[model samples]
Target: MDKIMMWVMAICALIGGVDQLAGNKFGLGRRFEDGFQLLGPTALSMAGLICITPLLSLGLEHTIVPLYRILHLDPGMLGGVLAIDMGGYQLCKELAQDPAIGRYGGIIVGATLGCTITFTIPVGMGMLGEREKPLFAKGILAGLCMHPVGILTGGLMCGVSLGKLLFQSIPVLILAILLVFGISRFPDGMIHGFRIFATVIRSAGTIGIALGAFSYMTGLQLLPGLTPLDEALKVVSSIGIVLLGSLPFAEILQRLLKNPLEWIGEKIGLGRNGTAGLLVGIVSALPVIADMKRMNEREIVMNAALLVCGTSMVAAHLGFVLGVDAPATGALLAGKLTGGIAGVWMAWRIMK
Candidate 1:
């Protein structure tokens, strides 16, 4: 599976690179460029956190571990509070008693649930207009309702038994329920809370980077277990490399699926903007969010739900998994795609 994915990425790179050099008539070149362009932002968001995850894990072990263990859950499940790229994998690996559970928690749970809480809710609310916020919240609530399907599917793919998966997911389920209630009942407050959460994460990432740089330059260990700045950056670089191919491949896939998606949208009563948003959101959610003004209320709500687990699946999330855990790429795809589609279906029923 790893070899096949590598080959696929290599082929994508070849095509993207050639298209870029040959005047980019196909526009795949832009996506190829986007991969590199993402490095700075990605590093800003995650590299620092990665460097300090070992230290964080130690603290978690002392504080959160006992309670989780008492509940018969893996401590690694706590790491799913952060996005996959933002130290979730490192923390999970560090805290896990069971390696399989760690991988399932960090990659599968983190990408969907963690990403939604840390990235999607805050960022999505901040970007949309006031009128759209409530609609977006409704969509997110719907998505949250269906998130377990994705997590369960991904867990099974990671070789976790259904019973074990459910057992370990107790905390996650509780937190998710809280989130749903918060978004549904207190949209404004939840938006504020998510923004503050994102701010705190960014602040922590910045501090981690500063400390890592200081440790590296002075050859003095201020923090005993800090991951080297260089090593953290290397992980970021690997993800970037994978993106070089994933982005262009996503572009190609979008182009091929464009007509079929439109046809499906027509039959399903989705607007043109909704169909376009679904396709674009796979590569990145920013564009779709930016263009929400063109969509009707139903489209806006559906998109918000879809993007909860679906955003960047074909691009950023895929690249991250392929770079970090190549074998889990299939699981990530299955979890995210199915979870996202389910969210859309649920939203349709709710709207009806």
Candidate 2:
């Protein structure tokens, strides 16, 4: 499966590259270019955190590990508090006694639970208008309710035993339930809290980058265990490379799926925007969230629910997984897609 995916990416890269050389007649080249364009923002968001993960892991191991052990859980599960690309993987690896659980936590839980906390809630709330916040909050609450489906599915796909999966998920379920309650009862407070949390993470990432750059330029290391800036950048570059293909491939997929999605939307009583949002949200949630003005209330809520687990499956998340752990790409895909679909259904039922 890994090899097949690699070949698929390579083929997509070739197609994207050729389209670029041919002056982007099909506009596929624009997607190719977008991959490179995203590198700067991606690095700004994550590189520093990656560099400083070892330091953070040390603190977490000392403070949190004992509690997790007492609960018969892996400390790596704590990494699910951060987004996958934002040092979650590194932190999980550093703290895990079990490598499989680390992968499960960092990739599966991180992408779903972690991304929702750090990126989805804060960023999505910030992007939407005041009028839309309530609807969005409700959708997120619905999404949170179904997040376990994705986490458990992904865990199983990652070869984690059912007993361990259930045990390890205790903390995630608790946190998710809290999030659900917070968003449902105190939307404004939850939004404010997440914004503060996101700000702290970004600030820490910037400091990590600065410290790494300083250490690289000078022979002296200010922090004893910081990863080199260059090393972190290398990981970013790898994801960028994968994105070159993934973005173009996503464009191709959107084109191919448009008619069917439209037909499905019509049958399901969803408007054009809602159907379109579902397809687009898979590539990245930002564009869909940004364009929510065109959507009706149903569409807005449904799209939000989908974004919880579905966002970036075909683009950023896929690129990141392929770059870091190619073998887990299938599990990532299955988890996000299935979970996202379930979220959408849950939203529909709630709205009904």
Candidate 3:
């Protein structure tokens, strides 16, 4: 019964795709209405959010190590440099810029030039007077998630300190600023480019989901050494996990958050722009993100967003992998929390 319920939700959610063709409320109805659009970017972006980051990292690791061994170089140290602009991280960053039509980008990079650089930057910047500026909340959410989230988290298990991890992100942080500047130069051609890329990526993802689900249901493992089929299953099922894990719980979480968030708003004079939803969004940032209405929240929303920049589940999950009793998890969580608060405050001051 539990499994049936879960599958039913998965089928509905997966088929729903973002909140366009389906979903109810502002996004509160039956999301599986236009089944035709299911094979579109929304579905792919959803799957890419979880799967693309991990698979990209996984594939790169496999490729780099093999090449390193052949060339007699350092195994782990001699890795790859990847600059990918497709997937949930990138796609969402692009979509959030302008819903009716816009171009947004999320970037993840890990390159070693006598040193290692692991960087992820989310952009919400728009052209001056263009009516579409990337929100700090959207940027923060993108930074903290996607495929690279796994690599940064995995670093913790390998004894990398949070400080060291943050240091590596510095380069990407600089690049991210430039990325925002670059996005402000958008034109008609870019939108077309985005759609074309999105279609290709989504088509690949949707097919992977179908193939992967079939393999799982029938207990078949076609690929022996590599994981072409396994990878497909992993990506699709990951989308299911996100939908199952985040959506249903969001309602309950939102209810619990109302009073506390309202109190904070009153105290801070957060006005109509309060970002309590961003905090509530802690459970599943993407869903809360999808539900955001730019017209309502203004300064306070931006403040809330800038406040929580560069923080996410990836950062905290690393600690758990260190063991519940381990000091690393607790330490990292505390650091990120404190840093997030301070960052938000500073951002408010500077942007003001």
- Give the whole-model CA lDDT for all candidates, comma-separated: 0.89, 0.90, 0.36
* lDDT string, candidate 1, 1-352, tens digits: 6668777887998899999999898998888988889999989888999989988998987898999888788998889988898888878878999998999999998898988888888888999898888888899998999999888888999989999999998888899999998888888898899999889988989999999999989998888989999999999999999999999989999999999999989988887899999999887878988888788888888888888788889898899988888989888888899999999888888887
Q: Give the clashing pairs for model 1.
A: none
Q: In order, how many clashes per candidate?
A: 0, 0, 14
Model 1: how large is the Cα RMSD against the reference?
A: 1.0
After TM-score superposition, the amount by which residue 112's alpha carbon in candidate 1 deviates from its true location, in angstroms, is: 0.6
Winner by lDDT: 2
TM-score of each: 0.98, 0.98, 0.45
Sort the candidates on lDDT, descending order: 2, 1, 3
Query: What are the per-residue Cα lDDT tens digits for candidate 3 across 1-352?
Result: 2344335445544434444344354442232332233224333433433333444445645675466445443232221122121243323222222221111012212211100112122212211123423444333333322223333443343345656544544443444444334433543343344345445545655655555455556777343222344453343444334443234333444567677777765655444334554454343233334334443434433433432332232211221112112223333334334434544444444344
Candidate 2: the clashing residue pairs are: none
The Cα error of candidate 2 at residue 315, in Å, is 0.2
User: CA lDDT of 259 in candidate 3?
Assistant: 77
Candidate 2 lDDT score relative to the true structure: 0.90
Over 4 Å off, model 2: none
